[model samples]
Target: MKKKRHLKKEAKIFLIGLGLLIFIIIVILIIPKKEKVLMPLFVGLKKEDAIEFCKLNNCKVDISYEYNIDFEKDEIIKQNKEKNSELKDNEKIEIVISKGINYQVYSDNNVNELGRIPVMMYHGIIDKKSEETSYTGGNVDKDGYQRTYEAFINDLEFYYKSGYRMIRLADYINGKIDCELGKSPIVLTFDDGLSNSIKVTGLDEKGNIIIDPHSAVGILESFKKKYPDFKVTATFFLNGGLFNQKEYNDKIIDWMIKNGYDIGNHTYSHADLTTTTEEETIKEVGRMYKLLKSKTNKFVNIVALPYGTPYKSTHANFKHVLSGTYEGESYQTDCTLRVGWESDYSPFSESFNPQFVKRIRAYDNDGNDFDITYNFKYLETRRYISDGNPNTVVVKNENVEKVTPTNLKIIGY
Candidate 1:
C-alpha cells in the first residue's frame, strides 16, 4: 500500500513541472519584438528632391517662401532640419524657399510719374491784354511775345489741376524726379529777365506790397497755396542789364535764389552766337558771367542763347557748345536750354541729353502753333504720372529678374 502512495506523489510532481514549462513558453510568444532604426538625415537638397528623399527615409516635408535678392527662385534658401539630423520615420521637416524681390503698389492722389518729363518755357507775363501797342519782329509772331496775365494765371491753374508739380532744373538733372506727394515733376522756365517777372509793385489798403496776381511769381505763389502741391520754383534765364532800370537789382536776384528760384545767363546784349565771332562769343559769355556773379555772388553756369542762337556760331570755334572759361571761373555749364517748341524727355531717363534740352513756348490767345497751350494740347498724352512710390524706378519690364529688381512699376510715359 505504502509503495502505491509514493507512485501517486511522483506522478503529481511531474504534471506540475510540465504545466510551468508551458506557461513560460506562452509568455515569450506574446511579448513585442524590437524594431530597426529607420530615421534619416536630409539637408541642402532641392525641395522636390528633399521630399522624395524624405519619403525614402519614411519622413514628411513642409514649406514656406520669402523674397530674397541673393537666391534664385525655388532654390532652397534654408531648411529647418539640421544636416544629417536624426529624424523619426513619418516626422515632418520644414523648409524655406526664395521668392525673389517683392513689390507694393504706389498709391495715386493727384500726382503721377513718367519715364520722361516735359519742360515748359514762358518768356514774359503780360499784365494787360487790352494794351493797344503791337510790335512785330523776328521770331516774334505778334505784338507781344508773352502770355497775357489772365491767361497765364489760367494756365497755372490748369497745369496744377492736371497734376503738374513745378521743379528746379538742378533737381531734375540730379535725378530728383520725385517731388511733392501726388504730383509729377514739370519744369517752368522764363526766358527773358523782365522786371515784372519777379517784381512786386503797388500796395494794398493795409500797405502790404500787392503783387500783380497775374505775373509769373504772383501766379506761382498763389497757385502753390491753392493746390499746395505745386512747387513754387522756376528758372529765370536773365539777359542784358539784368532787368535793366529795375529799382530792385541785387535784391531781386537774391530774393529769387533765396526763395528756391535759379538764375542763368542770356548773354550781355542778347548777341546771337551764330552771328558772333569766337572772340566775341567769349567776351559776350565771359562779361555776362562776371556781371551775374557780382550781382548774385552765385554760380552762373547756365545759358539761354540770345535770339535762341546756338552756343557756338555756325562759322565760329568747334568746341563743346557748353564748354567755356568765363572770367577765370571755368564757367562750364552743367546743362544748356534750347529755345524749343516741343516737349522734352525726362531728366531721369537714360535717353535724356543735357546738350539738346528743348522747351515749349508759353501760349496765349495769339493762336501760334508753337505756344505752350498748343504744344501742351498736342502732348497731353505724354504727360508724366507719378506712381506713389518714389523709390521704384520706371523701366521696361521685358528684362526683369529676381536679383535685378527695377523701379518701373507702371507702363506708358
Candidate 2:
C-alpha cells in the first residue's frame, strides 16, 4: 500500500508540469507580430525603373505625371522623401514624369533677345491730307505719311516671312513668359490714338479711300490672312483732351475699346511733363487716367509720359520705393531713372547732353522751317555756331560735303 501511494504522487506532479509547458506554448503562438517600416521613393528613377526599384522592396506606385516633372523625359524630377525615409510596408510610392523639352513659337513682327520684344511706334495714314488740324498735325510730313506706311508694311512683311507671332501688351504682361513670344515676338505700338491707326486700316488691295478704322483693320487682317499662325497686337495711346468734345473723344474711345485695342495714358493736354510744374503734371496725367478708367472701365496702368520725359541711360528713371532682395542693395538708389547714356556722351547730336537725349521734336512742315535731326546737346553748340540765330547746323561729313536741314525731326516711324 505505501509503494502504490508514492507512485500516484509522482504521476500528479508530472501532469502539473506538462500543463504549465502547454500554457507557455499557447502564449508564444497567440501573440501578434510588429509591422515593418518602408523606405522613401528613389530619386532620379524613371517610371519603369522606379517600378523595378519598388518591386525590389515590395512597394507600389501611387501616381505618375508628365507636366509635374522638372527633369528630362523618362527621368525622375522629384521624389516624396529622402531615400532613407522610413515608410510602412506596402506603402504607395508616388512619382512624377517629364515630357523633356518645350518648344513654343512666336509670330509678332518685332522680337528681341531672351523674348524681350520690340515696340514699333507709328502715326497718321490718310489718302488725302485733312483740313482738320487735330487729325492732320501739320508737323506730320506730307510724303512721310506714305513713306511711314510703306516702311511699316515692309517691316510687317519681314516679320511674317521670318515666322514671328504678335501678342498684345495686356496678354503678355499678365501671364508667364510666353515661349512663343520669346522666339519671334514683336509688338506694334502706335501712339497719339490716331483714327486711321493700324486697327482702322486693313489692307489696300482694292484701294477704295481706305477709311480710318477700316483701313488699319484691313492691314492687320491682311497680315493675319497671310500668316494664320501669326499674332498681331498694338497699343494706342490717346490724348484725353478729345474726350471733352462729345463728337470726338466719346465716339473714338468707344470704337477703340470695342475693336479690342488697348488705350494708354498720353496725358490730358499732351503737355511736356518735364517742363511742366509737378501739380500741373499730376493734373494732366490724373485727368486722362480717370477719364479712360471711367470710359472703358479699365485701370490705365501704362503711361507713356508725353515725350518719354526724364530720360536716364544707366537705369530706368522710375525706381520702386519699396525694397526687396534683388541686388541686395539700397532701395534709395536712382534705379528708377531710365537707362542713361552708355558712353557718357549724348546719343543725340553731340552738343546735347544727357538732358536733351531722346528729345525727338515734332516735324516742322511749314514753308519757313527746315527739319533736321537736332540733338538737344548739339543744339546749343549749333546755335552758338549759328550765332544764336534759328538756322540749320551745317553738318559736313567725309562722304558728303554738307547736309543741313533746319528744324528737322527725328525719323522714328
List ranges where model 2 is wrong by over 4 Å. 1-45, 48-50, 53-69, 76-116, 128-151, 170-176, 179-182, 198-214, 241-255, 312-413
lDDT per residue, candidate 1, 1-413, as tens digits? 99999999999999999998998888888876655434333333456877777767677778888864446667677877666556776788788777754433333242334334667777777665534324321122363356566666767777777767787776666555666544567888887788668666754586544555666788787776777667768888877678543666666676677777888887777877777787777777777777888887664477776666773334343243366776566556666777777777765455676655777766543446666556666656665556544554443344123212234443322
Report the error of model 1 at residue 231, Å.
1.1
Off by over 4 Å in 1: 1-114, 129-144, 180-182, 202-211, 311-321, 365-368, 388-392, 399-413
For candidate 1, the 10 contiguous residues with the lowest summed lDDT are: 398-407
Model 1 TM-score?
0.64
Q: Where does candidate 2 have its weakest 10-residue lDDT segment?
A: 383-392
> How much lDDT does candidate 1 score?
0.64
- Report clashes for each candidate as comma-separated counts: 14, 57
Clashes of 2: 57
* Cα displacement (Å) at residue 402, model 1: 19
